[model samples]
Structure formats: C-alpha cells, structure tokens
Target: MDATKMAAVGLSASYGRGPAITDINLEFGPNSATAIIGPSGCGKSTFIRCLNRMHETAPRATVTGKVFLDGEDIYEQDPTAVRRRIGMVFQRPNPFATMTIFDNVAAALRFNGRHSREETDKIVYESLQAAALWEEVKDHLFAGATSLSGGQQQRLCIARALAAQPEVLLMDEPCSALDPISTAKVEDLIFTLKRTYTVIIVTHNMQQAARVADRTAFFYLGKLIEVNDTKEIFERPKEKLTEGYVSGRFG
Candidate 1:
C-alpha cells in the first residue's frame, strides 16, 4: 500500500473550557515514525486524537485549525471515513472481552462494511501476522481475546487497527501499561510496521522515542516546544525548555 503524509496547520484542541493543545504545526512523512513526547497532561494524546477526529467524540470538545491527510483537510471529510483511514490504538490494550482473537481483528472490517467470510478470514490472518501475533495464536483463533497476556493483547489491538488498512496509525502511549519485555516487543513491531504505514506515537518514554522514531516532537503545557530528528532532539535540542525537560531538570 502507498504511504500517506499528514500535516497539521495551526491546529488546536480544547475540552469544554480550556485548550489542551494550541497552534500546533507539524508534518509527518509517509512510511516513517514520529514520536510525540511530553509530561502528563501535556496534550500529546489530545493532539493525536485530533488527527483522526477522535477528539470530537468527547462531549463539549472543540478543535480549531486544520489537519491534512495527503493535502486534504481531515475535518472536511466524513468522520467515519477519516477514522477508517487513520486508525488508533489507545494507551491500554483493550481487546473486547467477549470476542475471540479472530473476531477481534475482524471487527473493524466488518463494522466498516459487509465482507465475505473468506475475505474477513484472510484479513484477520494477515493483520495478525503483521502485528507479529499470528504464530502465537494461529492454533487458537477462537480463544477469547482477553485470555492472552497483556503484550499479546496489545498486539491484538494493533492487528485490529491494521485490519482497517489504515494509511496512518496513531498510538497513544501504547506501552505505558506493559512490562519491559512486552514493551520491547511492541517497539520492535513499530520498527517493522513503519515500512508501510505512517506511524505517529504519543509516549512519555524518551528512550523508547529514541529507539522507535525517526523524528521526535516535544510538547509542554499544550504547546509544541521543539521538533527535529530524534538524535538532535535528544542530543542537541535547540530549545532550552526541551533541553531541560529531556535532561531531567523539569517536566
């Protein structure tokens, strides 16, 4: 599949009364990974939620400015279509407890539209493989999704997103609840997945950002402080705020 480019122009979002992120401008290239990092409540999650219109789902939530997918304004498109094209995995691994692994992966495609059982199965298999969870679960596709370990469950969520065939994938702190081993596995998966999908991840782990992202963006108090190649952002940040935060001086 061809990769997609995403651009944010003067983008801002607010929940009810106050702004979470303001006047954010950034561009993400196709087939690459960009990590958004900051302290808690820094609006990194809110910024990614706006990329696919997920922010609007919150009651009284509002957004200003524009987010573009391949030069087209995302806000001008159908929300459902936008979501289908730009998929998200949350901070927690949330596989439906009632559904089997196969069904969990197939749910996205089935919800989008009708598909032959054969086609659904094919996609389910491919997505699991893409997520690096197939070999572990192929023999028990019918097993409940929650029966798997946390790491496996998170990969299942990733597979669910892949089943949508999204051009861009947004992950909001996907490793926060995972163990070191599980986190490493997901980090490896991120490296592989970026070969086809444009990946934007929100993470608090700066070392993880350095490991997975080609570029890094730092946000603080809802404002973008700096953006650059991961090495430069960590090794030679231009902004004192960024340097201080990265050096453990302050959040």
Candidate 2:
C-alpha cells in the first residue's frame, strides 16, 4: 500500500473522431487518493470511465494511449480482466432495483466466477463492512436495495464494487446527489478506504477535492492544467488557470 507504487502513463480519449481529452499523463500511487477536478464537460468523468474501459460502453467512444496498472498495460489486455482489478462507482447509486442488498453485493463475485455460496456470503459481508454499510443492513440483507436511504444506497453501490476486491477504485462525483450529511459520510468513507485501495475521484466540488485528495489534477478545456500535491494546488498553483479557477475567477 505504498503511495508511490502504482503509476499511469500517457492517456487520451475521444468520442468518435472528436477529442474529449488528450495528452493526459498521470500516476495514481497505491493506497493514495487522487482527485480530478474541473468544471462540467471538462472531461473529468470521461477520464475516469476510460480507466476501467467503461468508456467503451458509450456508443462512438474511443480511447487511445496506455493505462498502466502496476506497470502492466491494461489497454493492451482483455478489458474484462482489467475491470476486475479496477472497479468504478458512479455519481448515482445504481443498485439493481430488483435485487436485495446482499444479492447486489454478491452479483459481481458470482459474475466473476465465484460460484460457491459460502464464498459469496463471505465476500458480501466483507465488502459491506469495507463500505461501512454492514452495521446498518446486516440483519436485512434481503431487503430491496432501493429501499435504503440515498446515503445507504450509495454505500451499497460502493460495496458492490468492493466485493470483487479491486486494487483501484474510480469514483465519479460520488456525492453529487446527496444531502450535506450524506456527502460528509461518503467523504469520510473515501478517506478510510484509501488505506487499502488506490482511489481516483472526479469531482466538481473544489472543497471536496481540497479535503480528501493527497494529489490533485486540474482539467480545463479537456486538457490537464496542473497536477501537484493538494496543498500546493490549492494554495500556490503554478498555472494561472488553476489559480483563477481555485480563486473563483472562472472555470
């Protein structure tokens, strides 16, 4: 879990022939929190999606450049296997409406080829505990996932991702839809989770980035403007664009 262990090389992505982001080179150290901050449509979300190959799910989306997972090229191998090692959580809680809480967490394991009931159960419990949802729903594992509060549902979504025991976790504006209290809880959870999983988050909230990220990368007009330690990015940015945005001059 050393913060300097994992790194990513040059990465670029586009939709059809139109480039959304380009010349993006960065590294996400193991067990560290890296935040991508930008205004809406600045390609922060697109960047994270490309990390796990979810960009391919969008029609006409195409990605180029290499994404190295512990020095191996993820883009050169089977995307499914890459995704098994890098999980994602979206802006909204997207638990399957028809499945129960326990089943939602277990589905990823089952799909990844864990067929034993005992193994699935163990993974489900461990994932839920990791996501900080086990104490609330351990007795109601069969309850519909949607029945939980917005905060709980978001945590369940996180649990579902963790069930696969991924080495990296990608979160896209994960607290955007929640109340302040719920957002605080998710923020706290992100801090706790970074001890075991390298986390890359795309967030519009500058304060959130300043609060949680060890390192911060700023995006402007689909290009990376600056990347440095969070404190420097917030307090003494090297780029005028970064200072302007952080100082509320412009996005």
Listed per candidate, the RMSD to the true structure in angstroms reads: 1.9, 1.5
Candidate 1 steric clashes: 0
**Cand. 1 TM to true fold:** 0.97
lDDT of 2: 0.89
lDDT for each of the candidates? 0.95, 0.89
lDDT per residue as tens, model 1, 1-251: 24339999999999999899999999999999999999999999999999999999999999999999989999999999999999999999999999999999999888889999999999999999999999999999998999999999999999999999999999999999999999999999999999899999999999999999999999999999999989999999999999998998987
Collision pairs in model 2: none
What value does the lDDT take at residue 41 in candidate 1?
95
- Per-residue CA lDDT of model 2 for 17-69, tens digit only, reads 77898878888888889999988899999888988889978989888888888
Error of 2 at 131 (Å): 0.9
lDDT of candidate 1 at residue 204, scale 0 to 100: 97
Error of 1 at 18 (Å): 1.6
Highest TM-score scorer: 1
